[model samples]
Target: MNMSSNMLSGPKDTTRTILVIDDDSNFLNPLKMSLEEEGYNVITAENPKSGWESMEKHEPDILLVDWELPEMKGTQFIKLLRENKDHNARYVIMVTGHSTTDYIVQGLDAGADDYLIKPFAIQELMARIRVGIRIRELEKKIKEEIKKLTVLEMALSVADKIGNPISAAKLHLQLLMEQETVKKSPELVESLTSLFSMLEEALELISKYQKIKEPHSVPAPGGKTMIAPE
Candidate 1:
């Protein structure tokens, strides 16, 4: 069943986005309606060239494309997308009338993740999309966890490198505090004690930072989502 194009009014999705690249309105329009009805954020392009433009604009999590296009075939488009340096870990699925084993091999070898033949069942298509969404979410979560781990590793390294020196300095200050010569000068002893207290605070702060394994959310340079420290 086709759905109304008017998007549902609600809080914006913090979920997956899909970009569909196909020149055929008969195919593209209905596919757009079906996916959107299923609550996906769908963006469409008429051809492969404009599809690249949309890719640059959205960096969608999932890409749905038709095989036969005007300027470039689906194979060429997938190859180009894989080569992009700033590319997302997008799931690319080719929807084509070509159903031969040879065509499927060609698409997959060129970096298309999955393929669907024309007149495909909408239910099956949704199933494939759900699989792609699951993979995307898992990868994103793993990446975030890795970033947090890396930050903690760095913090630990910094603490290890600086810790010995602070410990040694504190010991020397304590020795000075105990000396009769040093204890005779009240002002000098007080200064030494203050410095000793600061070193203790530094060690405490490092202990607290080391204990934090949870990821810290910070605004990405310009991206919409938050990024954990690396």
Candidate 2:
């Protein structure tokens, strides 16, 4: 068994990394050079074991795996990666000489994001890579939006629970401030006045928060943006 590994750097502006796992040196060498020429960081591993090690170390954005590997089939390797949460999100493209429907279905079922038959055009492969990148980016954005919505829902729940208490506290403070004993002592009057004002502000803010029908973005410090009630 011939095992080999190589890492080739592409253009500095390109940040996408692609890992190619194939035992055929003749096929792997040119493919690595082609991918690098197309402005992608390329890592080549001749066997599945080395490929898995490289995946753990580099966490490449895309995987180009040959179907027949030395230690395990490409589908099995893809399945293994899918089972591990850390690598599951990475896009996988299975390369195989077989074009049978069964093989294609098997690879897809094993968690390959795409399948490329052997002897494919580099242009087609590059196009597939572009589509994969776009889909991955869209998925990431969707996940971020979902997380933001979840946080917003939790915030609304907390605001609901605390709203009545804040209003009650403000009302009680108002009643206490109206008492003769508090009004007689200047120091007590001043302290109670400040406390009442704070409670009033809290109630007002909670009222605004609970009435939020939509979220709007507001500029924050350091050129950042924060979500606010619209």
Per-model root-mean-square deviation over C-alphas: 4.8, 5.2
Q: How accurate is candidate 1 locally (lDDT)?
A: 0.81
Q: What tens digits encode model 2's per-residue C-alpha lDDT throughout 1-230?
A: 11111232222327899999999998898888777777789999999999999999998888999999997999999999999988899999998897999999999999999999977777677778888888888999888777667756777888899988888887888899899988999999999888888888777777776787666557889997666665
> Which residue pairs collide in model 2, if any?
none
lDDT score, residue 229, model 2?
A: 68
Task: State in Å the error of residue 24, model 1.
Answer: 1.8
TM-score of each: 0.81, 0.87
Model 2 residue runs over 4 Å out of place are 1-13, 213-227
The model with the greatest TM-score is 2
Tens digits of per-residue lDDT, candidate 1, 31-126, equal: 887777777789999888889999889888889988899898988999888888677367999989998999999998989889988877777777
C-alpha lDDT of candidate 2 relative to the true structure: 0.83
Q: lDDT values of the candidates? A: 0.81, 0.83
Which 10 consecutive positions of candidate 2 have the poorest summed lDDT? 1-10
